[model samples]
Target: TNTTKELTYSEAMYLCGYLNGAKKENRDLTITEREIRRRRSAVLKRVQRIGIDTTDWGAVNAFFLDVRIAGKKFRELDGEELLLLIPKLESILKKKEDGGY
Candidate 1:
């Protein structure tokens, strides 16, 4: 049997914050911003529950969390815009968690 749990919006939010902080605070962090986003998306895609579309929602949540955590505010971006940001966020999150960053 397979068991799965969807990430809470807050969990995703925490991850996004973690990713952003890791990048900003860890200059010695070797991972590229591009790679970080990619890894983050991979994690989100792994989610089996919650959100209408895990991949899309993950990306949007990531971008919003990053922007908000960074203390930079901007106009609302459409889903497509957020989708475009997933890979970047994924890579960052992965590297940081893996200790590559």
Candidate 2:
């Protein structure tokens, strides 16, 4: 059986944050939990990069937790999770560039 899993909005946002942080920090494909928390600011940068204004950090934080990416807070995700998230983030960025966002 072939089943496709769809990511929720919060999950997508979390992945976007991770991707932006990784790119900004020039780090390896996988990062530690401490790094993820430290790099939460990257999420705002990424949203701005996509031409979206982020004046609501509270909402962003809530969304991150709602998605359960790092449980209660941004933390280290497994390498396997990062691998899956990277492609999704790339796709979102491409879509934004294509004016699909």
Candidate 3:
């Protein structure tokens, strides 16, 4: 019956082409996203060690918005945004430890 119907040659070729391209998507993105999250977590942990209340969501959001070039929320940040934010956070951390903040 219907289940036994064979795909036409062009239909089969199209499906194969779609699968070949789709299968390779997200592999690089997933790795980059994981690395970004890891670096973000490490920066936050260092902030916590300096006595900033990382638990308070509003303050965290405010800090991110203030320091971020794009003013994006924490979760909305991608690698490019995070790359820009990390250096600023690290600078503040260093200044705090040096009694500058």
Each candidate structure's TM-score, on Cα atoms with residue i matched to residue i, is 0.27, 0.34, 0.60
Q: Give each model's whole-structure lDDT.
A: 0.48, 0.52, 0.70
Predictions ranked by TM-score, top down? 3, 2, 1
Q: What lDDT does model 3 reach?
A: 0.70
lDDT-superior candidate, 1 or 3: 3
Ranking of models by lDDT? 3, 2, 1
> Candidate 2: global Cα-lDDT?
0.52
- Lowest summed lDDT window (length 10), candidate 1: 68-77
Backbone clashes, each candidate: 17, 1, 0
Among all candidates shown, the one with the greatest lDDT: 3
Model 1, CA-based lDDT:
0.48
Instruction: Give a tens-digit lDDT track for model 2, residues 21-84.
Output: 7453544434564555444445445534655445665554453455533343233444444444
